[model samples]
Target: MKPHTIKYAFWGAAFGICFPLIATFFELWMSDVSLSIANVIHAHSTQPLLWIIDSAPFILGIVASFAGKKQDKLQELNTHQESIIREKTESLQKRNMILENEIELRKRISVELEAAKIEADSARQAEEKFLANMSHEIRTPLNGIVGFTRLMLDTEIDDQQQEYLQSVMRTSNHLVAIINDILELSKIKAGQIDFEMRPICSNEFFAGVMNTLILAGKDKGLSMNVSLHTSLPEAFIGDTTRLSQVLLNLINNAIKFTSKGSVTLSARMFDADFGTRLRLEVQDTGIGIPADKLESIFNDFQQAESSTTRLYGGTGLGLTISKKIIELLGGKIGVDSTLGEGSVFWVEIPCAACDRPESHAEVIRNQAEPKSLNAKILLAEDNEMNRLLAKSVFEKWTQDVEIDYAFNGKEAIEMLMEKDYDIILMDLQMPEMDGFTATRFIRTEMEAPKRDIPIIALTADVMSVERKKAFAVGMNRYITKPFKPEELISEICLCIERA
Candidate 1:
């Protein structure tokens, strides 16, 4: 209740208690009057009436003194209660004001936090765009580095010059590989990678992976093998390129870590239930990872430890990419290792059955020869240096091979319209038009005869998704930059032969 309302209640209660005593006093006065009248009737009226008037003043005085005392006590209590009510009201008001201020402060803080979040999101988007542009910029030149390197390796040169060029070529390829892996990791982090599943011939897939892994394995003095159940399907609908990368990374990691023992890559049917779940294992007899360090290996840019990182040279992206690719393909991967005994990394995925399984397995063999770029080739590159390097590489490789150069996609289209070429080396990023748009135009606008030429992607951006994109854009082959001369030549030879 309000402060004044409480005072009113106390005052009203004091008045209510006084009413009974007031009535008693009224009755006493009436009795005294009646006796006075009675006595006056019986005796001389004038003699007794004087005594009553004289004592009346004294009786009124006594009653007034008693009422004054009672009223004083009641007023004292009212004053005390009023003081208490004032103090309590003041405290309550202060507390309420404080709470109101706190609420306002919290509201302000919440608004600031929301603003910070919005700014952070905007900054993040800008950063991503910048990184993507840089990726494209770096990739344009690298395409030429590897493409031209391959063309150069096939040329006639002194052994000493060939060896020096080989080293340069190797380093470039290595840098390109690292760049590609980083880009792939970025794509995975951004959740922009798309996976495509189709009928992948297991034997042929293993052969490709094995061919890629052998040189690295041999360099480390390591031996690698592939073992799979014969009952497995000849072809399964899955991301074969990703699966190959997954295998390639694991096997390569094995080769890197190991010094003496052979690394065996074994695959078997772990579980058949739920439609062809297979367990693929890459067991290495190398320096095994500690039990505690096993989990950290899958994290980005993280290795077993600092000491281990120094011992083994890598950006530590292979396993991270491998793990992501496996997960993208609807699977899981893990590691089992001991201190010195060995380590086994494995992945398991669901594979859909192919329509018609091939009856005979192609013989497992190694194709290490670099692709032959001696045939009439058209290189569609935007950067002048890249174009020059590519042209020089072709000129140096085969003296008589016809090489048509285009600085942009538009030039490439004109060249294509004018002359027939055996293969087209196309770059995904360009100024006038990108490879994807140009490829689409070539496929949709050109006649069947014009569109039939093999188009190989010359890029530094090599990821599972990018490869799928190359295929999507009507590219017959996708070759990452800084590639080995042998690998480049082999890819071209394969494309030309297939075409």
Candidate 2:
């Protein structure tokens, strides 16, 4: 039926017909018959074989047509298979391209995120450095101001002059407190706060804190009381400094708010599944917080009332810092108040009971009356006013003490090389050489007695890292700026006694 099949059939029929006619002619020639069409027809008509030969053309045509149909079917099948293969190859290529594009996009996002993280870290480091520098610059001048003011108060002056100096001292102290609060909050937010686990005597700790703050309340014509429960342990394991800080903030707040009535600080202990828990409460009878706003007061820079800031004049970070400190110590803090009567703030922390340490008693006894220090001292300071303040303070203490002054760490080192000094009062920040390097040189490069001399770090930097580094460089003690003259003298006496 197809054209190829018809062509194959026609060629097959022609070959068959030619073969039969040739055979008939060949036979006639062999038999000596006339080689003509008439003879060939007679030969074919007479022979049975000739009749069979005559049907060959038709059978051959039918066979050739079937073979041609099979060939055509095979060609069609091969073309269809090739088409399918081409489409599948293209699909695979497109999918691979899309996958590569997705991978590239993810790689770019990862790079950008890494860059952002690096930038943020750099900025935070820069901020910390700036704060450290600022603290040093501010505290250096404040130390001289406070020191000179205290000395002035001791001299003969009119009542009005005394009043003015006292007010200046108060304002300066308040400013120092604000600076401390800001630095503490920054350390907390940066996760740099560390707590010490040591034995703390309940009575001694509470007594010390009360002694420091009771004067403030009494000056305001208010009574301050401390009540410890009988069941409370004599000593417990906790961070004494951190606990004192929290208690100071709470008691100070209590005294600040209460103008007419008394304030009370109380503590008790209870058993818990984890350990013994200590609960501290500060109660004040003053202008109390509103019922609706009590919970929000602990938030940073937040107060119970909007106008409370103007009336009280505070940064409002006290309670917020206290809350953060308590939480970091694995404790909780809360407050309860009425509108008009009073308010109570409480803190609970887990502490295990421990025996009263003998070392604490020894420390208390040693603090009684420091022996007079009559020795040669090296004072290394870069500030002129600070140097004059130190000289005045020492002159007031005793005439037997001889003090030598060095303008910088380099001068101090040079003085040490030439003379034998009993102690070195070192300042951390100085030109030409810093205290850390000088101390390191003394400890590592100097001879026996000079290397072993007591070195105290009298610095304005209050960051924990600075303190740690000071000790690491062989500093015997670290005292911050604006320190009391009595405290400095006592430390000097102690260091000399130890040496």
| Per-residue lDDT over 1-499 for candidate 2, one digit per residue giving the tens place of the 0 to 100 score | 7666887888888877886887787789777998877888789888888788888888888888787777677767787888888888898889889889988988998898889888877876777777788889999999999999999999999999999999999999988998888888878987989998999889989888888899999999888999999978999898988989998998998888888788898999998888788999999998999988988999988888889888876778899999999999999999989877889999999878899978633442123332356879999999999999999988877777788999888899999999999899999999999999999999999999988999999999998889999999999999999999888887887888899
lDDT of 1 by residue, 327-380 (tens): 887789999898898999989898665665556765433343223345788899
Error of 2 at 55 (Å): 18
Clashes (N, CA, C under 3 Å) per candidate: 9, 0
Off by over 4 Å in 2: 1-106, 227-231, 270-276, 356-359, 364-371
Runs off by more than 4 Å, candidate 1:
1-128, 140-162, 200-208, 229-237, 272-276, 351-356, 359-380, 396-499
What is the TM-score (0 to 1) of candidate 1? 0.61
Model-by-model lDDT, in order? 0.74, 0.88
Task: Report the Cα lDDT for residue 127, model 1.
Answer: 59
Best by TM-score: 2
Q: What C-alpha root-mean-square deviation, in Å, does candidate 1 show against the real structure?
A: 8.8
| Highest-lDDT candidate | 2
